[model samples]
Target: MAHSSTASDKDPLYLEAHDDDDERRNLCGTFWKRLGFVGVAVVIGVVSVLGLSIGLGLGLGLRHRDHVKFTTPAIVTVPLQSSPPSNFVLNGLKGQPPQTRVYAFNVSNALGAPDGVVRPMLVVNGMFPGPTIEANQGDRIIINVTNNMDVPTSIHWHGLFQNQTNFYDGTSGITECGIPPGQFLVYKFGRFLTFTFGEFSGTTWWHAPHESYRCAHTFTDYSTQYADGITGALIVHPSEPSPPDFPTWDQDLVVQMNDWYHTFSSQLSAAYLSPFGIDGTAGDEPVPESGTLNGLGQYGQGGNYFNFTLEPNKTYRLRLINSGSFASIRFSIDNHPLTVIEAEGTLVKPYTVSGVTIAVAQRYSVLIHTNQTVQQDGTFWMRANIQTDMFTYVVWGQNTDVRGILRYSTAPNLAAVPVAADDPGPGMSWVGDMDTSLLVPAVVDSPPERTRMYLVVVALENTADGRFLAFMNRTSWEPLSGTTSLLLVREAGLERHNATSFAPVGGSLQDGDQFYVTEDSIQVVDLLINNLDDGDHPFHLHGFRPWV
Candidate 1:
């Protein structure tokens, strides 16, 4: 893929994304491998407006959302660990110069079982459910990711606006080519070079933790690294003190929940993309054998459960992120109500509920008061149940409820704890189940008057060749071989174009796939996403949090 330079090539912004000779070779296989697994259909598109752009894409599976009202139930909360992991402790940001935080990520292959089934896994810094990346609003975050795996890989800073550093967006072939096997890439967000939290601070995550590690170089796409471990919690605290109206807690905790599979993602992807389904059910996504809370759960044989020790009569803020590749999870504790304060980083008026349902790639911040009396065994079950009803088919004896122990500091013997009798099955109504959309943001701003609009209709297409693919309108997104849309846009140079003239910007737009480039300018655009699939889809925008 030869890059044709235009007059604007010397511009500073374009220079920032320019690649060297070696990188050009790596970029060829980068995106194609990252997104190669066509097993699950995903649609990605970019719409530029207001000098910013929105990168929208569909999550794992379409979800069926049940609308529930906000409730103010009597609730309690608590955090994990005797003290916050030193790495994740939030330092004061007020009256201090911003600091640069560095994390060394060594992405490699390992073997571990989150749910008792040992399998090949991808790990970061030798830890499954990788270390927490905690930073204050304005602090710089520099993660030098070294790919020690045999395959190429990339990391996406999900939900973070890359601002001027679009190359660090970490979508192979889209932003910049992925790092090659045994190579390294420095992802800098925060400070002036790449990103600054600015006014935004909230719960968001990276895939594989950007777990879409490009697994195989074969024609099929495989990005199951996150599923086979390699994901973690990323917490960005508000630099300013909690507003007087915001919910407060004595301690903060992080819990990352996800569906677990015993098999490697590559194998599962191969089965999923096979013309014949796993068990004669074509187009049925692979059902997970179990679920995990903070990367620990159990199956028939052996596995450890995550435990959160709490002090009595204390309020805590629990940050929850669903980093799974699939499966919508219903999270709850035995005898406590969760008071929702934040949804995907937006502070909201306190809304209480017994349990909250979160889909893959979604996040929530809830405060619980640990005021409940200790159980007889001094342990409560923190249940993360897979909404198995959403699956197209069911596997026998598949345990959907993944439980963790919530023990109090006063418990006489932690080893004597028993599972809660009332821990229910999938789809069973946990008391006070609430829909996140119903919660209102603490501060609401009206969108500017729209000057343009795009309607993207999403649906599952059963192609003539007997394969199920997801499409946005008439096009399904396949990466441009060996190059990225951003690269092409840079080569061609940026120019303003109105809605009527908008067209694909990269190489020849293939008949079944498409990618577009938008000028970095102002245009208030309203995007309407219509999902025609029976299931639900969680759409995520990389750099913008749109008002839904």
Candidate 2:
């Protein structure tokens, strides 16, 4: 959101903060304020060290909550002839297991700007919005992640069910300490997705789950890491199909989108989690700098932009992933309506929509037809608009209208941003019916009655020390020293306990607080959440994808 700019109104700080190439370090601490629960889901696609993200359950009928960090590199180091991922159609690998695959990534630091400017960033394999990693259902994957940077780091396979391999979940404190700087870890991909679709299919993502003994809860610590550049796409394919109604398309395209911050995420987090917060806005969240589609976007930046080329009258399968850590995004193409076919790896009956409102950590696969008459030399605006209403403390981006170019016959290299062309005329909007879609075949069944019901109150509260904090119930979470929660719980087998508690020692890095809950036995459970604040919030139950 660009504010009214006049030569007379310009200030050095404003000009410097706006320029990604300026040699300014953490200048945002002087500019402004906001915050969220999501890995700070990182740092809305930046990378985090130490923590591994895990999926607790993959059952017959539900999808679990994911808070893993997603990342993208700042520099555009993609070699020649690499196209955006395919969409709409089932992936090439079948879902049947009995296979193993491995990929090694060197995580390091770099300088570049996804929004066409330069800034400090974390990179995986020299590309931001990291490369797409695909595997068939039931197959094993070995992700060999090497820390090539000075800081410790890790990767959590966001939506995968780590069935028996809880240690492999990549949760730093809860699973294992992060890979030390100059160290490497081989994550043996566990068998996660076991529920086969009789006639269903969908998409999911992997992000940084910043694990920290410190700042395990808020923006001050690991939350800001992955918000910049470390997110990637993981596509699971089914081996066979029982239904004959799945739609087929010529090209499959993966469109990864999320909200972005211009200043360093740590700086944004400091402003967000500041004492009493910025300007006395105790519960306000930090507003993001802009939004991105596939790791590239330009907000009011002239010349080169992120664009997609298509052939007229051709159907392209598009997989949409919300890779941001905080802000929710709504997407729409100038003249095209999308036919959504899948949600969160679960196949549903195809539905149409003019645009979609996507929350953080959500994914959808839609089919778009390039049937529009070539206008503006076959160029149209593809908007990835941030939902400002979903947040409270938006210091900037009040007019977050991030755009890219789309053309049927134009070269992919030539594109621009926010160019105003006349509307494509009044168009129809589509509302998603998750309930109806869930009833489709291959539904996983859950036990009828819940053995235990956990009540969580989502709240924004002041700590005893007067720090403004976001939490569930009343307790702030702090990780245990030297070991993870899983190992602790496993070791406490003979000890009588309903829940566990530990206190932090004096003089540690000031981070947010987090606590934990443990179950006595394996019984079907119910989670009841009540919001104590008025603003928008996304609640996720780490470990299991439960039926909602």
Candidate 3:
């Protein structure tokens, strides 16, 4: 949502560090803290910082136990298909015991031209956008990621609750030391739902996943690495039909969209982070040169449009993921109304809309009945347009309207050019949509009867040297060098540090971006986010689902 506030807070059991202004007072009541920042800000209310160390130890123990040994499977060589097959559904997986899947990925540099202009990009297993990780709920997924590139990197399993396997979170500096260049790290975790009603059932993703690091372009690097390529879809099927009777689809297809940048991610980050932001404008995020659907788009240079062929009359579930580094996308198809069913990972009551405006790192699964009569050309334009207004400055030749083809099997001319439909005008977006009540969670898991509320402000600030920096109240997050906070704290022992705060933990709060909790009991928190900045920023919790 643009220029509006949202109330979404993470689970209190697993709290990330952030600075707070209050002390241990009123152990049984609600509290509010005012924090301001320019970009995205995390509102964390910690009752016990010791959980971080405990979680990390549990995760490490799970991976290194003498009894648990993993035999690496052969890495798939073929380029990952853009969408899953028609038969990829959960019905077949029911009644089977959970199985473990092991995968190995080689992270390296390569040249790709999704828009017909080749550029150096980071890739997994020699492919852009990596590979899809498909698994049913409750399956253990062990991935061995080897760094073949010159730089060290880590892969954050976005949205997957690490639970007891917190060390496998893949967050560099916070959870574990990054996989150094030429070295590999094994990420072992289970794909389990966090809530009663299949909380993490639908579409999710995995990316470079960085919280703030010390480098100027590190923020961009988080965006850049994934933007360059290392992004992929992660589909977790529900053990049973979510909400018991929610309708199922005949075909499950993934439509991954991203705003494409021709320039190197590092250069773009440097310019955006620099004092003179791209033409003297401070804090202007680098606008993408083009947008891509399923990693392909016909833009300035020339490229193939992602095509989706379907059998008529069958209900298809389109797992839409906005894996772009920046820029929220508005997705729709000509003459097709999308019936929204899932947001991020939570399944919602079916609501139909012309289009869906998906923010970065957000996912939505919508069902579309392919009942449209076969047209002359057999095709309808699938549009994944980037919201240009979200950008501070406009690029002259930028192609915001990224299109693909949705062809029916009964069309007369499969080769004929498809006619574009009239403008849909800015359709319904989760953020800007007026009818917020329409997309209610299928199962309403109410928050605790008594909860703590925190007020946080988000804004951008210009440093003395001219660099633009984001802050929440008094501090900005910068990663601890050499070792991760979790590892450092675990090695130093939780007994040495106060359970409530990281202040006594040396080098943990030097950046002053994190806060801690002194209590051990489970507590509910309400994080009220007020976006003071100009654009629509998306905030994500690495390991837990936030009740909105």
What TM-score fits each model? 0.80, 0.73, 0.77
Candidate 2's C-alpha lDDT? 0.52
All candidates' lDDT scores?
0.60, 0.52, 0.58
- Residue-pair clashes, model 2: 65
Kindly list the per-residue Cα lDDT of model 2 for residues 18-89, writing each as its tens digit.
Answer: 111111111111211111112210111111121111111001111222222223424343221111323212
Measured by lDDT, the strongest candidate is 1
Q: Which one wins by lDDT: 2 or 3?
A: 3
Candidate 3 lDDT tens digits, 275-391:
787546765566677878876665554555666667778898888988886677889887677888998888888888778988777789888887775355667888988876556
Deviation in Å, model 1, residue 222 alpha carbon: 4.0
Model 2 — TM-score against the truth? 0.73
What is the TM-score (0 to 1) of candidate 1?
Answer: 0.80
Give one digit per residue, the lDDT tens place, for model 1 in 1-548.
00111111111110011112222234443332221111101112352211000012234353433332122221112111111123222333343557777777777776555555566677776555676777777778877787777876777777775555556777654665576777877776533543566555888776542222222233324355667676667777777766576766777777788787766777776666556654454466776777777766667655556667677788877888888867788888877788889998788888888789897788998887777764655667778888865565555446787887777766687555555577542222554678765898777766667655667677776677776666766566554555655554544432323422223432233445653534233455566878887766677666666666
Candidate 1 local accuracy as lDDT?
0.60
Off by over 4 Å in 3: 1-96, 190-199, 211-223, 421-437, 488-508, 511-519
